[model samples]
Target: MDGHRCPGEDVTVSVLATVARFLARSAYEIPEKDLRIPLERITTAPPSGFVVSGFAVPPADRSAEDQHPA
Candidate 1:
């Protein structure tokens, strides 16, 4: 039994499935790196919600970097 498995349970596998499983297993331990894809850049103004009788700009999460400027 693989060490990752629950105790007393046996897993079935085929040859190709075994190779695929090994690659997938190693991938789990690799650290993920953050990337700035263009789609990730949110350059658009976020839709404003109703505030102060639906007139004023809504309050935002100020601590966050993606806040819209007044």
Candidate 2:
């Protein structure tokens, strides 16, 4: 067994699945240096969303002409 099963386990699994899906579709790896975790605040509450900061914008998709560079 991975660990003791707890209440709201389904919700936890769902959130992790969503994050995994997003990571799978993303091309770049999310660096730890850019993360800002609020360690001062701790709560045993549901829907505790996280905030991400200091990320660079991804490059724009190039058109066929731009790719070939005539």
Candidate 3:
């Protein structure tokens, strides 16, 4: 057998590869690679006042202490 999911085969990477190939040919394009999200980013907070995406530096104040560049 060509390692296909005939009936009760587990849905492992092998089966996915075969299906992906078929879809790519049918769609007239190579299958797009999986874009894995960065796991470390998931637990972290996003930037302030910039919508929820990733951490960002807070806006600087006009005080003397804030005058120092990081």
Candidate 2 RMSD computed on C-alpha atoms after optimal superposition onto the true structure: 10.5
Question: Residue 41 of candidate 2: its Cα lDDT?
Answer: 62
lDDT of 2 by residue, 12-58 (tens): 99999977765555465433553345666675322334445554333
Arranged by TM-score, best first: 2, 3, 1
Error of 3 at 66 (Å): 74
Task: Provide the overall lDDT of each model, using Cα atoms, as 2-decimal numbers.
Answer: 0.41, 0.57, 0.47
Q: After superposition, how far is residue 48 of candidate 2 from its true place, in Å?
A: 27
lDDT digits (tens) for residues 1-70 of candidate 1: 4468754444444656765654444323323343334445476332342222222222333323365555
Candidate 3 C-alpha lDDT tens digits along 1-70: 6766556455676789876655444423233444444458755443332222333333333343477756
Q: Lowest summed-lDDT stretch of 10 residues in model 1?
A: 49-58
Off by over 4 Å in 3: 1-11, 28-70
List runs of model 1 lying over 4 Å from the truth. Answer: 1-13, 27-70
Higher-ranked by TM-score: 1 or 3: 3
* Model 3 Cα shift for residue 34 (angstroms): 20
Output the worst ten-in-a-row residue range by lDDT, candidate 3.
49-58
